[model samples]
Target: MAFITKTHQEEALAALQDLVAIPSVLDESQAKPGQPFGPECLRALEHTLALCESLGLRTFKDPEGYYGYAEVGQGEELFGILCHLDVVPAVGQTGWKTEPFTPVVTDETIIGRGTQDDKGPTIAALYGVKALLDAKVTFNQRVRFIFGTDEENLWRCINRYNEKEEMITAGFVPDSKFPLTFAEKGLLQVYFEGPGSDQLALQAGGSLNVVPDHAEYQGSEAAAVASELKKLGYDFQQQGEGIAVAGKSVHSKLAPQGVNAISRLAEALVNTGEFANPILEIVGNVIKEDATGESLVGLFTDEVSGSMTLNVANITITPESSRVGLDIRYPVTLEKETLVKALGEVCAEYGVTYREHDYIAPLYVPLDSELIVTLLGTYRELTGDMTEPFVNGGATFARAMNNCVAFGAMFVDTPDYLHQANEQWPLASLYQVMEIYAETIYRICCK
Candidate 1:
């Protein structure tokens, strides 16, 4: 509250409203040479960088459309505030009271996609730095806001940024909740393939990071599958020619909290005793309803980030080939190869060979580091909250750099609506978050 004013709050909120108005979801169909992720992501990046320039910061838009940045101050040490513009697709997600892309502002809240995920927080941090600059505060280190374009997908944008942009001395990803996050679980996405049976065909789910909400299969063998799902007491519905098995959808990192619709369907199919797909058998018999990697005999558990979680993200089966995708978040202290090897051992029994689709190594920073100390001190001084830094299965831009961690955008009471239906931001927290960022930046970089 010290650095930001009512006028500044109005300006910041207006900026966020304008940003949330854009439906900047990843669209590969409109992808071109310079716009690798798609036109929307490129547009979002361009818009965000332009906003930064409008705020009187030096800005640069990447020619390849993978990333962008805005900066102020001059020093050998560079402080980064990592943010992303691209958000998860919101069109099909249920439970929206207003249009997902249309920013609906009330007296106390703003409802829109990307509001709480990253965009709203990004604007808060931007104005936070702008506050110090406007007050003519001299920075002892360079402060830069690195805009990422493909954070919801494979992180190709930030990967391109790391390949092309200058590395920061240290920073925080404004994309996550805090006190602060000191560790993150390792993320592993694997694609398993096996021989396909011409007798059956199936396909379900999307976005390797989101657990499917409904496995509505509308193909061959509907009656049998439905009968089995009913006998199994699974939540499902009959969809004319097929059946839809219902599951609670959530981010893959929080798989323990969600139900895997794809797995549900697979279980029903296997129980039918009519389907002979090896992949389906594995999903039903091997991994059945287990989020804690219990199928693997608890091979992936650690004290820092807790037990490994698995989500049957997607599946596709055909006569030519059978494929299934998995999203696994292992502990930071666990060995990746050991877990990978254990998975392969079990999967190989069904003639299913596994290949890693993507892998992000875990992130860990000591609680006593200068960056942690400064950010934590700033947060405590502002809120009087003594909650220590913690770890989770979530992955953020904090993994993009060595000295970075995820600092608070959400306080203790803020519900996490990131990547969820009806994502929203509380208006009351905006000024406080901006003030926190302003103060944190001052203590960490300006001083």
Candidate 2:
């Protein structure tokens, strides 16, 4: 009576369809009225927990909106599988071939916002757990699946989970690339304010982590800026009170090196003869240096997160002030104080104010650890693919646990469109991931 039965596969597909049907994007509109984490995220978390309950597994949930479980198993030292149900926002007009939230099936690929980034694998892991349970696998350790609601923006949900849950012996997160992830660069969010106030009209980007494919701004003085960009072959759209600047959407702001919308807007301003604003000038300087971390202050790069990235996600201007939110993913090896010192120097130079908010230091587990070997072995056994464990810049809940590493749901060759328009996952890969999870759980439990 193993969990990997045909019945389990049927349940897996059914659960995936159900999970994808819920438009679980972290709605920004809910930020001010309800929880800082969106209600949709909370709903997704509940849905996941209820699914766990239906599978006949013991579960744990805190009022603060995080949950975990001791799946049907027996072991003293718990083995953890960390994953998240929350996802980034998806704009409808972002040129999605299919509606971003609607789960579409084309050529065996399940397409939606969370399919590749996390939600698909989250369900896959659930079925994997089911497989292990149904198999009546016996072992010397407990297997717990930890699901959080805020992995898209911040990891507060997991932070809270660790505060109340039991420490895990070893585990992996199915949220990142396959093979394995041994290192994750630290994360830092830098907020900057410049001298321009009341006179500036602006709009560009959303979410510091995402590369904005479209953004623009307009004011009484916007014509000059628009005209300048037009000369560069940039087309600006006049929508509502502002303009829309467009660019291609991409992921992992560090790699692929896509054009940043905020950076592009700042460049437009500087080139359009609007550099009179000291704040705008400072922004230009910041981009020119391409500095995203504290290393520039001392001229040494932080190696863990690699170089810092300046993802100027959101911008706002009032009659009296202008501010920007920068998502800076820091190197794990760099000291937090070093980043602080770097910010202090930059702030002093531009006369712009700066602040550090939502800092998550990097998490690295030794590549040769038993937990890693076990997870890697499970993956290799299930897929017969020999891939090495590596490092990634994207953060996951795996780092939130005492002994954990991110496993896989996304194949190294397949494009899942995580955080991009028309995200998706192949059904074959989904089944493969479930089988891998089942093996990982079973091995970890038995050993």
Candidate 3:
């Protein structure tokens, strides 16, 4: 019993290598100018669209600066395979054996920024669509492979696409943990402003969506917080009264709870009374981490998507106010107003203000749906592995469609370096994923 694909693996691998060579880190500086994101990310998108155009496929770039689409076949029902090209910032000094952006192939793994996070998968999806087109598979649905640009920082790309285009039927996104992802917890990235006296200097945590790997504090009184962190076995350095604490970086924040460095640092600051701001007192009184905040929906625990998760991404202090930007993934059943009420209470009590800068509702696709059955069956047929669809705490472009689920690309048994240093995907796995996607596209479109 062997599963071999007629799809061109060499072409897929070559495309993946070419995509890996591009450094598509979102440029905050260029976000306002011509490219909006940056030259590299825009190049990544253009490269994808050009590849699609080479296949004689019709391409469309939505009005919003974040999305591009390639359409093939002509039919009433629309099927989509959603993916992104943008990647998080990767630095060379981040303890990587090879350059973070420049991908290097080991025995089985392809190491680079978007290797596993997105770029590799995006290429795989493109290859899959190419296979279907080359095979002359005709069906009643128009298949669109959407490559988004802002999946890392924001979802402006998909938002703009959905606003102008028709809704998709059922499709899969090759992001996040695989087999199948049935549920994605609701997400809210916010800025929590509070009072600060400039007595404590705090720094660490790279982004809201990712767990912070490095954080530090400055000040003599910070010793208490540093000492406590040291007691907790955190890799911390004390320099001129400032302390740097290091923790593990993980995606799907709710799945990996204790690895959040920023949360741990904030806890230490609160416990040591290092934050003289009244907001600190209020947060300590009301939002008691996993305890008092249980009243919130996802703040509790659920059998499906687990409990509420929080990652305090960044903290800023000024003469007028102090703030902590937080990324929270709550449960879908939880009411936004209820959580806002609780936060508002704490903010009012502490003379602080709360604002939700980003709100993406949890995406829940029924496991029993035809789309799920078809996708799951196709995966099992290819891999001969019986696995159930699961949930993810990380958001994906699948949520942009009316009926779509993240199918493959990332797996449960593999090491997923999504949004981390030296992100990579096994080359063998990449080939298999391309074949799976090819079959999935053909079956959905030609059946």
Best by TM-score: 1
lDDT (C-alpha, whole model) for all candidates:
0.87, 0.70, 0.72
In model 1, the Cα lDDT at residue 439 comes to 92
Model 2 misses residue 66 by how many Å? 4.7
Go through the candidates in order and give the C-alpha RMSD of each one to the true structure: 5.1, 6.2, 5.6
RMSD of 1: 5.1
Q: Please, what are the lDDT tens digits per residue for candidate 3 over residues 217-332?
A: 66677769777776656566776767766667765364245455555565667778556766444333333334213532224556776677766566655556677766777765
Kindly report which residue stretches of model 3 are placed more than 4 angstroms away from their true locations once superposed: 1-7, 28-34, 63-65, 89-113, 190-281, 289-292, 295-301, 310-327, 341-353, 415-424
CA deviation > 4 Å runs, candidate 2: 1-3, 26-44, 64-76, 87-117, 153-156, 192-252, 255-287, 290-295, 302-305, 310-327, 345-353, 388-390, 415-424
lDDT by residue (tens digit), candidate 2, 135-227:
666767877778877787657778877778778887878888898787776667777786556656666667766766776676765777677
Number of the top lDDT candidate: 1
Ranking by lDDT, best first? Answer: 1, 3, 2
- Which scores greater on lDDT, model 2 or model 3? 3
| TM-score (all chains, Cα) for each model | 0.76, 0.70, 0.74
